[model samples]
Target: MASPLEEKTVARLVAAATAAPSMHNAQPWRFRFLTGERVVLLHADLERAMPRSDPDNRALHIGCGAALFNLRVASVHAGLAPRTRLVPEPEDPLLLAAVHLAGPAERAPDPDLARLYPAIRQRHTSRHPFADKDVPEDVRATLREAAAREGAELLFPGPWHADTVLELVRDAESRDVMDPAANEDLVRWTRLGPEADTAVDGVPEYAFGPRKRDGKAPVRDFTGRRPVADRGSTSFERTAHLALLSTPGDGPADWLRAGQALERVLLEATLADLATSLTSHALEDRDLRLLARDPGSGTGQVQMVLRLGYGPRGPATPRRPVADVLDVV
Candidate 1:
């Protein structure tokens, strides 16, 4: 039998898990460590769910899944083997996953996961403009492999497809501007002025990056109509480097898998010295999501659109304290 895990160790793991990214940095997840069972349960904090933007809770599941992936990486780094089960209990829909933390004696640590340990803390979303340069084919392959390991697909759209995805994102942006209801979640989740400095969660104004003076990138403008001090405008890349992450199905399970894959790819990209940012604008709506998929092979459901390049990495966003998001049982 594996030895009991120390409470501090569990806390450390949960801390690392919370570092995972979520839409607007909402960090919509809670952790429960069952001491007797030697398992950590990931739960969705539905209170943080963006009902106006994500009524189906798909983004919520994806955020929780990213947290779960971080837990696995943290466990591996701590010399533990994390055996994970997704949605183990059908009756408990909010219980996204249960990770059994087996000691090193029971199972060997995964080197792949262990190698990614450093990137966990180093990775940050770069919303600023990336250099107008190509991400070499080799680095792209590594990112694709990272997504595949988590049961998802990553594809770099050609010029035409990329243009289509960007247009869809613009359409989503227009819809948000006209639809007051759609911007409710954005208003709630964005931190402005003094609030940005002290808030424990949400996207801070400092991390909002510059307004796109000229660029095809689909970066979300968090400062919608609201004025922000010291915010400037700059030219982003004329030709944005966008990649699409997709799954075979469009269900809860698929969303979770896509989330894991999304983080994995992000971590890998960070390690490869590539600055990255995510664009879920187009994927927010079912209709636009379908249009974002590869027209040549319209098979999978597009879950995320990632922008990669060489540029300034965005500052680390705030996260809720571990005590606020974790429970022991």
Candidate 2:
């Protein structure tokens, strides 16, 4: 039997978990609280998997990891410390974790982390052009520390490295434009028009930033096929800030850690009044992945590339209702 306080704590954790961002806002995760054992189990909802974009379920696992991190933070706020086990069982693929709770007195909540909780709901991927002002070096270092605390590495590209990444993104954009299969996959999730039904989760029309007529650094134009009218445009910074999130091993556990780190960095940036976006274009290709990896650095593997700067707030993407995701067992 569980105490009323325990039940209340679990409910609050679930609410916070749902606040995590997901690819295309799929929210592909499910949670169950086991009262007798005082544990919360996170499971990847395979039905919600993005097969085309995430063929191997890596992105799905990443999204679940983000949710798991949120659960931990929420647990802290609710006077508990969360102990997690990633993919606790090999036989049960859907069984992602069993979180054991430690009493609040056992640990003190991190002050910086507590500050970021408010920004969790406010962080949105800003796709529009960033202001010409550069991100301070110290702030970038702080963001790196946030990711490192979550078991990942954040790589800030130098001028040459940034150019390499930009070129890779351009290559990916060109390939995606020519590949019928890739185009179809993007088309499936991209909603057209402002009045389009918001039930399905994906990149909404309004969220797609205006296309660059002069063809500068490649931005994933979600509205490539479906043209929109009167879209506003702004001048993007010439020197873009790019960071790579990497882990040691390329497995389920590593993928989860990378996801958590990714969100932590994003939330930290949000609290600092900075805008961020992620582009996995180069990471999606094997050759480009090799180029992105630094042999000297012991970082596990690059999971995602993030762009950080000061820019307009991106339009909020839609999310599935709590009732649609939560199941009381």
Candidate 3:
């Protein structure tokens, strides 16, 4: 028989899982611990889904997958091997993943996952400007290896390709301005004024970073052109260090794999003392996604565009309480 997992241990793992980044900091995931089975079920909270921005729920699934990855890491760090089964029940669509914590005999943690534990909290989506310095070739290789380990590809685009991706972001930003529905998510998930200080979920105004007075970093302007109190405007990096993450196919499973790869790369970047941010806005549109892919290597579907550099890390955003997102069953 499996040993009974402690409530405190389960809570710690859930807290670490919640720290994973989400689109607009929505943090759209819930956890249910099956004490008898030594398993935890990860479910997507559809209520947090962005109907306008992420209509097909791809981003939602990616966010939940990220949380699931974190849980595995936390479990390993706590001296338990996490044997995860993705989409364990297709009939129950909300159930995105189920992780079985290995019992006493099989509880040796994976050193790889355990080493990344400290970076879970350190990783943040830095929307601010980054320096013009290029990421060293060695670091680039390390990041690529990290993604490959999780069954995804990470490409540091060459100048010409990077410019093409940048243009796609510009086009997406322009479209966002004219499309009324597109702004719905930004409004719903952004916290302003005093709400920024107290709200437990959503991107606070302070975390919005500075407005793009100039330059092209592809950071989304969450203020929706309404002007934020005490917000400043500054020029971003003219040549933002951008990396594209892709998978062999475009399906729910591929998206989950991409998410795990995404977190792995982010944690490695954080450990390397690099600041990072994500921009899925450009990939929101189907046409834009097609354009965002590498012209030379047109094989995989692009899932996320990451901005990396040396700069001040972002402030810790709020997350829902563990009780709010977990249940003991």
Alpha-carbon lDDT of model 1: 0.92
The candidate that achieves the highest lDDT relative to the unseen native structure? 1
- Per-residue lDDT for 30 in model 1? 91
On a 0 to 1 TM-score scale, where does candidate 3 land against the true structure? 0.98
Q: Give a tens-digit lDDT track for model 1, residues 115-210.
A: 998999999998898889999999999999999999999999999999999999999999998998899999999999889899999999999999
Root-mean-square deviation of Cα positions for candidate 1 versus the true structure, in angstroms: 0.7
lDDT of 2 by residue, 1-329 (tens): 32434455577778788777777666789888776666788999988776666777787788889888888877776667677888889899998877876665655555555666777678887788876677898898999999889889898877777787788888878887787687665676677775545545777777888766542344677776666777766556776778888888878888899889988988888888999888776767656766776545634688888888788768777766655666555
| Top TM-score prediction, candidate number | 1
Local error of candidate 2 at residue 28 (angstroms): 1.9
List candidate 3 segments past 4 Å from native: none
lDDT of 2: 0.76
For each candidate, give its TM-score against the true structure. 0.99, 0.90, 0.98
Better of 2 and 3 by TM-score: 3
| Candidate 1, pairs of clashing residues | none
Q: What is the lDDT of residue 278 in candidate 2?
A: 83
- lDDT: worst 10-residue window of model 1: 279-288
